[model samples]
Target chain A: MAKVYNFSAGPAVLPHEVLAQAQSEMLDWHGSGMSVMEMSHRGKEFMEIIHDAEHDLRELMHVPAGYKVLFLQGGASMQFSMVPLNLLGDKQSVDIVNTGHWSKLAVKEARRYCHVNVVASSEDRNFAYVPAEDTWQRDPNAAYLHYTSNETIGGLQFPFVPADQGVPLVCDMSSDFLSREVDVSKFGLIYAGAQKNIGPSGLVVLLVREDLLGRARADLPTMLNYQTHAAADSMYNTPATYPIYIAGLVFKWLKQLGGVKGMESRNAEKAGLLYHAIEASEGFYHTHIDAPFRSRMNVVFRLKDDALEESFLMEARKNGLIQLKGHRVVGGMRASIYNAMPIEGVKALANFMQDFARQHG
Target chain B: MAKVYNFSAGPAVLPHEVLAQAQSEMLDWHGSGMSVMEMSHRGKEFMEIIHDAEHDLRELMHVPAGYKVLFLQGGASMQFSMVPLNLLGDKQSVDIVNTGHWSKLAVKEARRYCHVNVVASSEDRNFAYVPAEDTWQRDPNAAYLHYTSNETIGGLQFPFVPADQGVPLVCDMSSDFLSREVDVSKFGLIYAGAQKNIGPSGLVVLLVREDLLGRARADLPTMLNYQTHAAADSMYNTPATYPIYIAGLVFKWLKQLGGVKGMESRNAEKAGLLYHAIEASEGFYHTHIDAPFRSRMNVVFRLKDDALEESFLMEARKNGLIQLKGHRVVGGMRASIYNAMPIEGVKALANFMQDFARQHG
Candidate 1:
C-alpha cells in the first residue's frame, strides 16, 4: 500500500492495524464462519461485539456508573433536537454558549422546543475566540446549559468547563471527545459524533446522567427518548450495527494504545508540532482562532498570501498529503490530526510547512 | 474457513463476492488511499460512491424522476416517527395497517404524533395474514395510508396494493424492497431498512414523491427533515459512510445479477424449496401464515411436537444451518432466504429437513 497522510476532518484517518484486522476478518469474524456484518444484532455473537465495545468504551473513557452511554445515529445534529426534546420536558428554557458553528446550530434547533438564552457569544468577532465566562447570561432555572467543548468548523475549544451552578450541563463534544481527559461527572450529558475522533460517521456517542432519564415530554417518540434508549441499552431499536462494530474496534485500539491518558499526550505532541511550525513561519502562516481557545485536534491556519493557498494544497496533495482543505465556513487550510493521526504524520506536515514557507515566504 | 450458513434475520447474509470486494478495497477504494470509512462525506471520492449508488438504485427500482431518494440513518424504526412528523405535521389523524411487529411499532410511534386510525389489522389472527382493503377502517380525509409490504416476523405479505382513493400510499418495504419490482409512481413514499435485503445495517433507503417535499413539520431536525436531506442530496449531515458504501456495492451486485426480475425468480425458488419441505413433512412440520399471504423471503414454521424444536435447531446448527430460531413473539423456526441465498443452500436445507424429520418423526 502506498504511504499517505489523511488530513480530512473525519470521517478521517483510522489505524492501519484495525483496518487490516477488519479486512482479514471480513469474510469470517473469529471463525464464526460468518462475517460480522452477517451476524444478527440480537444474536449472541453480535451481543458479544456490543458488550465488548461498550465495555472498552467505558474503560477508555473511565465512564462512571450511573451514566448512560448511548450509541445513536444522525451525528451530533440529531442530538441537538433529541437533547431538548428529552431534557426540556417541563422546563421551557435552556441557556446556550455560542462558541462556533456547531453550538450555534444547537441554539437554533433548541429554539423550536424551548426558550433559548444565548449565555455567551463571540459571533460579533466572527467567532475568533471562545467567550469569557464572565460575559455569560446564565439562567437560574434553565433546564440545561449547552455548549460545544470543541468547534470543528472554527477550530476553537473551551479552555475549561463552566460552573453550571446547579443547572444541568449539556455539551456537544462532537470533534474533541476522547482526545483528552474529561470529568464525566460534571455534566448532565455529553454527545459526540464518532466521525471526528471515535470511529466512523454513523455511530454517535451520548454520555447522559442517570437522573435525567425517562422524563421525556410525552410527545417525544420512543426512539428520541434517551430514557427509552437507556432502558434497552441502545439496542431498543436496531442500531447502526457495522458502525458500532467498527467503533468497537476503535475502542479496542484505544485500549491497546493505553487509553485516553496515553492518547492525550500523543495528541498534544501532534498538535504542538503543527502549531510550533505555524508560529515559526514568522507570520507566513496565521491561525484564525484565538490562541488559548484554539483546538488541538483540528489545526487550522491561513497563509499570509491568499494566492499561495491553492499552490500549497496542490503540492501537498502531490506529496501524498490529502484533504487539507478547511471547511467553507472557516476557510484557509485545516489539518485535522485526530487520535489516529501519528506523530510522524504531524512531523511531515510541520516539515512540509517549513519548506513551503522557505520557498514562498 | 469452516462452511456455515448464517440465517440471521438481518445484518444477515451478504454475497461473498461483495464482501471480498469490500475487504480488498477497504483501505484504498479505487486508489483513493483512504478507507471509504475515512473519507469526508462531502469529498469527491465519497460523492462518487453516493452518486453511483443512487444511480444504480434508481435504475434497479425504476424510481420516477419526480421522486427523491434519501439515504438516512436510525433504521426503519426511526422512520416510524419521522414519517408522521413530516407528513402529518399539524394534522390530527392518519391511517395505519398493523400487519405484524414492524407495523405495530410504526403505529405505536405514529400515535405519538397523530390520532392513528387502524385502517386494517391482522391482530385477530396473530398478524399471520394481512387484513384486506374491504375490511379496513380508513378515513375519507385521512392524511395517508401506510402498510408494510412484508412482515418478516409473521411471514406475511400483502397480496394486493390497497386503493388509496387519492390519499398517499406509504409502504415500509424493509424485508421485500428491491427484491421485487413495483410501480413507484403509485406511492407517495417508500422506506426500507437496508439490513434486510438492500445492504448492511445502519443505512436506510427512503423514496419520497416530490409533492411531499418541504412539507415536514418545521421543527424536524435537519437529518430527520426530508426536505433538508432531499435538498442537500443526503449529505446534509455526515451520513452512515461505510454502510452506505457497502450498500452501493450491493446495489452494483444486484445490477450485475440482472436486477429485480432475476432476484424475484431466485427468491421464489428458494422460498419454494423450504416451504415445500415444510408442507411435505406429513404434518410433522406446520407453517403459521396462510399460503395466500406467505412471504417469499422468510419461511416460518414449527414442528408438530413443540418440545422437539430445540433439538431440531441444535441438530440443524451442527449440520451447518444456524439461526433458524423464530421471533420470540412467534415460537418455532424461521429460515430467511434473501436475494443472496443460493438455490443450492436451500436444497441442502430442504434435504436436511427431510432426513431429520424422517428419523425423528
Candidate 2:
C-alpha cells in the first residue's frame, strides 16, 4: 500500500472522498436495497441523483436561465458528431478555430454535415500556441462558431473569447471545464467529458441553450439527437446510471470544497508550482506553448536532450508518479494537474523534476 | 435491514457478490493504487481487466474466432445509428423485423442511411408475439437483416433464429445477452447493452464478424468506427473502465454459477414458477403475450380488470417487490427475472400475485 499519484489524464484521479462515499454505498445505496447500478433510470432515487448533479453543475458554473444541462453518455466524441447533427440542420457551413486535437475532431465530425471553415489555426506551428482573436476570419452566416476552450493534447487554451457578434459560439470544454469561472451565456453550447473535472469516464455533461433543442434531423437516433435527450431530461434511453451516480458524488465533493471559485485558486496554485519548476529548470526542460496561451490544466514540456525522455518517465514511475507520458503527437511529458490532483502531488513532482535535472544536467 | 427485489428492465439489478467485490476494491484495485476507473486505458492493470472480460465473454458465448468482441459506449440507442453507419456503407436497403420498441428504433435509425424494409412485424398485434418466420420476406441483397432477440418493453422473444442463408444476421440481444447459451456462430453480429443480463448500462458489447470491420464511411471519427476498436483491441479511446471491471466481476460470478447453462436452468425454473402462478390464477391474472414467444427473462402480464393493476403494483411495492410497473409503451406489470434475480424472489412475486388474484376473482 505504498503511496501513488495517478496523473493519467482522465480515467484520472478522482477525489478520495468520492471513492470512500461510493465504497460505503456500493451494495445498498441510501438503504434502498439496490446498488446505484441496479436502480432504474426512471426510479425516484436515481432521478434525485441526476437532478442534484445538474443543479450543482449549473450553480457551480453560474449557468444562465433557458439553458438545458444534459448528462449524456459516449463522451465528447459523440458530441462532435451530435452538435453538427443537431445545430447544423439547414445551415450548410460552420466556422472552427482549430487550436488542437479536440477541435480538429469537432471540425472533422462537422464536415459530415456541413462545410467547416477554418477560421483560425495554430496547426502550421505544430499547434504550439492558441491564435489571437483578431486572426480569426469570421463566417457571418455560419451555423455556429466552434472552438476548444482548452486543448488537452496540445496544452493550449484560448486566452480570449471569440466576439459573440450575434452568431452562436460552442466550446468543447472537455479538459478544463469547471476549473475556472466563465460566462455560460457567452456560449450557446458547452460540453465536457466527465472524466476530466466532473468525475468518471462514461458520462458527459452538456450545457445547451434552450433554443438549440428540436433543431436535430428527424431521422437522428434518439440517443444522438439532442432534442430527444433534452425533452426527456436526458432519460430518453437507459442512461449510464452508475457513472451518473458517481458524477453526482463528485459534485457533492466539489460543493464541500466551496465550489468552482475555491477550485480556481487551488488549481492556479498547483499549476504555478509546476510551471515555476519548469522555468527554473531552464535549459534542461523545454515547453512548446508560450507563457500566455499555455494551459493551466495540462503543461506539456520536452527535455532538452530528447533521448533522456524515456528514462525520465521510467524514473518518475519508479518514484510512485504515473502517466506523466505526453501525447504521442507531442513528445516528452505532460503533467495534467486536474482538480482532483492535489497541490502536494505537484510539489512532489516539482521536487522530483528539480532533483532529476540536477543529476541529469 | 429490509430486503427488496428489483425488477426494472435496464439499468436493472446486479448480483450482490459483484457489488461487494467492487466496493472492497474501489480505492485500490488489486494493489494497483488506483480504482479501475482511475487507471489509464493503456496501463497494464486496466488492460488486463479488459482482456479478461473479453476473454471470459468469448468463452461464455462459445464465440467463433472469426468474430471480434467490442466493448463500446452510448448504449443500444447509439448502436441504432452506428450499425447503419458501419454496415450500410455500400448498400441502399436493409431488412428489419419489428418485434417491439427497440427493433422499431433500429429500423428508424437505419432508415436514415438506407431504405428499411419491414420484413416481418408483430406491431399490428401490439408486439405481443414474434411474427412467424414463415411470414418474413427478407431482402436477399440487403446489407444486413436486423432483429431484436428480446423486446424488454413488450416481453416478446423470437423462439427460433431466422434462417440466415449467409446474409448476415444482426441481433440486438440487449435484454437477454447471457441469460442462456446459444450458438454464437449462427449470427453474423450481436450487441448487448450491459444492464440486465450483463453488468451495467454504459458498456455495449458487440460481437461482429471480422469481415464487417472497416466498412464504415471513411470520415467517421475513430471512436465510432468499430474497425478502430477492433484494431486497437477496443482501447482506441478511454473506455467505460468501471463498468467493464464490474462486468469482469460478473463474468466471475457466472463462472461460479457454472456458466450460462446453469443460469439457463435456474432462469427457466424461476420463469416457470411465476408464469405457472399466472396461468393457475385463471382469468383473474392475465398475460399479454402469446405462449410460445414469451420472454423467459421478462414476464409481462396484466390483471383482467384493469383497475386492479394499480393496486397489484402498489401492494407489491410495499411487499418489497419494486419497479414492477411496465414500460410506458406496454402499460401493466413486467417482472424482469434477470440473472441477478433469484428463485426465491420469483416465488415471493408469484405468491403475492396468486393471493391478489384470488381476492380479485
Candidate 3:
C-alpha cells in the first residue's frame, strides 16, 4: 500500500525514514540484544541513545549553556500544572496570554496553583488572532509571563515573542516546535509535547534556564519538581525509553533536513499551498483566522455550506488525504502540515480541495 | 545474530512476536493509513485502539465492573505521590511496609504528601526476605496499607498479600505484574510501571476500585487526581499513545498464551530451572534471598568468591546471556525472567551459570 498523508493535530505525522529506521531496529537496537523498549534507562546502550538525542536536539535548537533540556513524560498538559507548581516560588500571581483553547486550558490549570492574570486575550475575536505583544498587559511582580506560541486548535500563532519585562518568558510550543528556529536564550523556559513535531506521545521536551531549576514550591510532588529532574538528568525515574529513542531518530531526521531553518522554509511552503487553495475557492470556502496570525503548522478552513463538510472529509479520506477534519470546537477542516508533512502531501490536499470545490459548487 | 536473553530490570524483555507485529504496522495501523503514533487520541481510530486495549486488559485481569484501569504516564515513581495525594483525603497518615529499594523510594515520596508509618521492614537483612504479614504493625486508622509486591533489586516477592483489614490495599507491582495470576479484588489500588512484564516504559497501569474515587486533596494538581483520569477514561490528557497501543498488543499476546494463568505456570517453570542450576552449583554460587521469598521474575545470586563475579559475567555475555549484572546497590548478578522470556532463554542462562561456576569452582 502507498503511504498516506497524515495531518493529525497531534500524535501527528513523523518522518517516514525515522519510522522505517525504528521498525528495522525493533527487536535489537545496535546489536545490544534488546529492543530500545527493553533497555534499562541506566544501561550504557540506552544512555548513549538518550545522550545523543539530547545533544542533537541541543545542537539543532542552539540551546544555550545555562539551559537544561529535560526529556520528561506525562505530555505538555502535565506541564501546565508543573510550570506553576515549579515556577511560583513565593509569588501569588502569574501573567498569561489567552490565544486559544490550549492557552485557555493552561490558564484554567494555572488558576489552581496561583492567581492567574490573563494579561491579554484573543477570545473576543473567537481566538482567531494573536494579540500583539506590546498590547499584552504585564504584571511586573508576577512569577512569570506565560503564553501559547502556537494554538493548534485555532490555527493562530504569535509572530513575535512577548518581551520579558522583568519576568521569565515561558511558552508552550507543542505544535510549532522544531518547525522553525527561535532564539532559545530569549525565553526562560520552553516546553513541547513530542507527539506533534518531535516523535510520539508520552514524552515532553522541557528547556529551562539554569536559574529556574530549584524554585519549585516545597509541597510539590518529588516527580513534579523540576529540580529533582534536573538533578538526575531527567532519569529521576525510568523515563519513556522507546519514545526518547524515537525522538532521537527524529532529531537525526531534522538534522538531515538541515535543522530548524530548513524546516521553517518547508513548513512555510506547505502552509502557503493549503492557504492558497482556501483563498482560491471563491466564496465556496473561508478561513476565520485573521491573515497575519495564521499558523504555518495548522491550516484551518471551512466550506461555505456546512452540510458539505462531512462529504468533503469522506472524499478527502477516500483520496488518501486523511485527518483533515477540524477540531470539534471549530467545526471545519484543519490541515496540520508539521515538519514531516512533505510538499507532495500539501499538493495532494490542495488538488483535492480544488476538485471538491468544482464538484460541490 | 541470534537473540540473546535480556535480563535487565525494568524496560526489560518483550515478546519477539509482539515486536515483529509492531514493526510491520509501524507506518499504518489496520489500514487506517496513519501510524498508531500519528493518530489523534480523540479520533475514532485511536479511540478503537485504546478501547480494545483496555477491554483486553480488563478481560485478562478479570477487573470487575466497578474498577477503572488507567493507562497513565510518569511511571510508578509518580504514583508514589499520586497515591497519597488522591487517597489521603482528610487523613494525614498511611501505613507502608519497607520491603526494598522500590518501597524505600515510595516511602520517601509519600512522606512529602502524608505521614508514613514504617509498619514493618526487611532492610535489616538487606531485603533478603519479606517480613511475615503477621509481624507487621496493624495501623487500623491509617489511610491504606502500601507495599511493594516485588523488589527488582533485592529479588524479593511477597509470598502472600497483606490482609486488607478494612483499610485499602495498595500494591506497587512494577516488576512482577501480569507475570502471574493475581486476584483483582484483593486490592483497592494496584499500579505497575509498564516496562517489565507489561509492555514499555513511560506508561503506568493503575487499577483502582470505583468507590475510592474523588478523595484527592483540593490543592492537588488536576493531572495528579485519579478521578480526573477515571472520568476521561484515561484520555484526560493525550495519553502515552504508542506505549498504550503496545500494551494492547501485549494484552492480546497474553490472551493467546491463555491469560495470566498460563504466564504463572511458565514463569514458575523458568524460575525453577534457574534456581535448580544455582543449587546444583553447591557453594560456588549463592542466592542471598531465602527459598520461600525469592522473586520468580528477578533471580539475584552471587559467586562465593567475589573475584569470580566479573569473569562469570564476561563469559555469560559471550554466550548471549546479557544484563546478568546485578543492580549497583546489590553488587552481584541478577537474571530477570519476565513472561516474555521463553523457558529456552532461562535454560540458556542456567547452562551458562553452571559452565561459569565449573570453570572457576
Best by DockQ: 3
- DockQ ranking of the models: 3, 1, 2
Error at A176, model 1, angstroms: 0.9
Off by over 4 Å in 3: none
Could you estimate the TM-score for every candidate? Answer: 0.98, 0.96, 0.99
lDDT score at residue B161, model 3, on the 0-100 scale: 88
Model 1 clash pairs are: none
TM-score of 1: 0.98
The DockQ assigned to candidate 3 is 0.80
Worst 10-residue lDDT window for candidate 2 chain B reads: B216-225
Q: TM-score for the first chain of model 3?
A: 0.99
Give lDDT tens digits, candidate 2, residues A156-266.
877777888877899999899988888998999999998888887888899999997778876666667787888899888888888888888887888889888889899
Model 3 lDDT per residue over B170-282, tens place: 99999888988888898999999999989999999999999999999998888899999999999888999999999999999999999999999999999999889989998
| lDDT comparison, 2 vs 3, better candidate | 3
Would you list the clashing residue pairs of candidate 3? none
Q: Which of 1 and 2 is ahead in DockQ? A: 1
Give the CAPRI rating of model 1: medium
